[model samples]
Target: MPSKRVRYPFQVLALCLSAWGLAWAGPPAEKDKAPDAASIRRGKYLATIGVCEACHTPPAVPAVPGGGDPDRERLFRMDPDWVRYLDPQRQLAGGVPFILRLSGTTHGLVVTPNLTPDVETGLGSWTEDEIVEVLRTARRKDGRVLFTFPPHSFYNHMALEDARSLARYLKSLPPIRNPIQPRTLPFEPQPMVADGPARAPQGRTRERATYLMGALVGCRECHSHHENGTLVEFAGGSPSDPFQGSFRLGPDLPLRQLEKGFAAFPYPGFAVLYGSNLTVLGHGGALERVPTERIVRAIRQGIDVREDEYGRPRPIAHVMMWQFYKDMADVDALALADYLKTLTPVANPVGVRLKLFGTDWEAAFQQTYGEPPTPEDRAAFGMP
Candidate 1:
């Protein structure tokens, strides 16, 4: 008390400054500030692996008329330029048409919504919390449920922090004023796929890989069992054999395939490709003989480094969505490779490992889906 009575004004001022510094350096300081560069950077990475642009971004050229699957040839073509087909200026300005079907019956065209931050046309009015909620619950603020195409069931399993990061990144984007058409569903919506498992905790590399494969990257969707286009079961030793891969029917030519069943008739040539068995359990499972480096190559470069009958690696079909996965960070891709090697290798072979090995797929594509996108079209999308 005697010492305080003798304290100078400068000492009191110094004590106040010290207390202010401690408060400013605490956790709340970081939390209260706007989304920093690191968080935005993280969000960009999450968006890349999640393939948000695949659905949300429209094509550079107008889709072939007749309102059906736009890039039907994409199912078979292994062109590395597939990524350039999307309109760059309109990135995430959703208008991509996804034809959702059930038991071969066409429900309707679901034009993806614009994800930009435009106040009038995009998610500008949506708060960060609202965007995070959509990622968690797959339902819009208006209480409308989402379709299965975006594969919300898988995305809903994303970690909370990751989802928040995604929202922040999206909100930070330069707003684009692209108004999307409402989804045109001819039939009542039906539940096509079941929800994925709960979020895997953040820690080990394998756990991160698990979430990437099962949730964010959605490896289990096409890789899982599907009789036609309809998903039969999700995972866990069911006769369906999760991650065992599925038989993918080819393009919806003349838009008739959607009206009819996906399995009503076989696609021309090797169009009826099989989703390779990603598990190591099955005897003829595709990845069983493939090395980890090859898997990483396939994921990052869209080239299946697995040896063919002639012992040469080939390009993966464009339908595999490697163009999107190609953007994944090395650490994430490596983690996925490590985790896949640890699966309970299931021996469920779906189709021939090298269906396109001997076929003239380019000529077939020209005959079926018309000449591939021209260079002018590619340039429009900002591809060299």
Candidate 2:
């Protein structure tokens, strides 16, 4: 037995050593690693701050099946809805069908485009770099740069990490394959006032103005009104009926109404109340018709261009006019004006009459005046 064991091993040992050497070599260096779960969650939170859902998620009705029922656990789960309304063939397609009364007559319901990851119709093909570039530069595929993109600018003040997280969250969304039509503006193209040499700022001034107007000041939020009378995120214009000069300011109308009343009756006289157009032109298409110098004067001095029977400059009754904006310097106002010039014109055909003196107004006035009228003792009160 000892003699046999000694003879069998020499060649076998060399073979075993060669096999072990091959086993030690590992996989190639080019393989990718999976994304971390933690990162995905962070991205989701960032997306909320960026308010992506406000645009992507279709508005739901109170009792409707897919309407946004606040009580529902999956309130903004857009995937299933996208598949329902959007064309199945289109990648990641989804839209909200909404009837926007631009004015009383000029109205139509259009779908707000879906932003999903379907390769054919969604953003499945877009790179992270492209998303970042679009937000930063406001350039579309055709090389036209837009000044604003709604709630995205709300996150303009967000940290870089937050922005990246939002981008990642957007990527994680299921791609819907619906191609959206380009948003149309009502007016003809005009050169941006900011681009002109007269009022253009240089170096730091330009950069500072851009940052303030785009992010901090949020001038666009009030300036842009949507077709449906909604404030279009960073888009300019108040949701004003261009013809009627009235729109909802959510629940803040009392303060404005009081201010208007005070301005109208500075000495207890009825004053005509007018709402600002918020367009580059002052209200009543004056900005479009008047010269820049005149526009500046109206904004600074609260002068109304339209005259009464006497042809005197109508006492500027719009109390809120230039008053709030007056605090801003000439340069700042001009910068704001420059920013306003780029707004996409939405045709807000004047809607129905907005009763400024409604029950609420009467109630407020009564509170200030005191005592309800009494019907008793008509003769005693000199009735006949």
Q: Estimate each model's TM-score.
A: 0.66, 0.34
lDDT of 2 by residue, 95-187 (tens): 433222232222222334455666765557665545544544444344554333233333335333333434455677666555654543222
lDDT by residue (106-215, candidate 1, tens digit) is 23445578889998889998887778767777667666766544346556666666666678789888899987768766454332232444333443388677777666
Most TM-score-accurate candidate: 1
On a 0 to 1 TM-score scale, where does candidate 1 land against the true structure?
A: 0.66
Which sections of candidate 1 miss by over 4 Å? 1-33, 63-80, 103-106, 186-204, 226-270, 281-290, 353-384
Candidate 1, residue 353: the lDDT equals 37
**Model 1 residue pairs with clashes:** 280-345, 281-345, 281-346, 281-347, 282-346, 282-347
Provide the global lDDT of candidate 2 against the true structure. 0.35
How many pairs of residues collide in each model? 6, 24
In model 2, the runs with Cα more than 4 Å from the true position are 1-33, 60-94, 97-111, 141-149, 153-157, 186-384
Error of 1 at 91 (Å): 0.1
Worst 10 residues of 2 by lDDT: 7-16
